[model samples]
Target: MSARSLRQVTLLTVVLLLGASLGLALSLRVWPVSCPEAEPYQLGRTGRCVWAAWAADAYVVDGDLEQARERVSALGAQAADTVCSLAVGDCATCRGGQAEAGADLAAALGLACPDGVEGAP
Candidate 1:
């Protein structure tokens, strides 16, 4: 092929690739995504709510800020429950790193983690 034709073909290939990539990204991100009914969470040994973050991205993509916040809050509740259940007696002592988890998860929810709710037995 001529240099001019080769350049045209290369440009066309690049455009096609870009379009396909963009389409795939959008398909994954757009609404109608398969979101979980609940946060399938388990408290890790290190005290992180491992799967509670599953809803945030989908809720955000759906433009439901309230749902996203609620999901995180539910995660926090689950984390606390795990702490309580696993603790031998004083649950207050084992409420571990969840303050940080709350903070990190809160960002995804577009809110800050609320305080003063810890310290249980």
Candidate 2:
């Protein structure tokens, strides 16, 4: 092949490789996890963490402080303390006295809940 054609082919290959690498990195790094109908214990770390956080929030909203604490305990003692704070009138925007601390903890853990109206009864 001509020198110019060879250079063009090499450049094209480099671009294609870079594009593929970027696509792969994004797919693996920012992928979504959906495990509806499964218990938190049945999921991977991210899914489990998210479920526990949301469940804690649900329990808090329902005035079930014991269950909320149990779910938050799965996250960690630090998380439990931070989240449980909301249960004790420490929050300014808790809905109808329901603490939203679980959602905060989930977000802090770098996970977003699946699309839907959160905290719907």
**Residue pairs in collision within model 1:** none
lDDT of 1 by residue, 1-118 (tens): 9999999999999999999999998876553333233543333333333454445546756778688767756777763344233322222322344444444444545442234323
Taking all chains together, each candidate's TM-score versus the true structure is 0.33, 0.31
Model 2 — which ten-residue stretch has the worst lDDT?
39-48
| Residue-level lDDT for 79 in candidate 1 | 39
lDDT of model 1, residue 29: 57
Model 2 lDDT tens row, 64-121: 7676656666777645444434333344433333344444444433333333314311
Over all chains combined, what TM-score does candidate 2 have?
0.31
Off by over 4 Å in 2: 1-26, 34-49, 77-121
Clashes of each: 0, 0
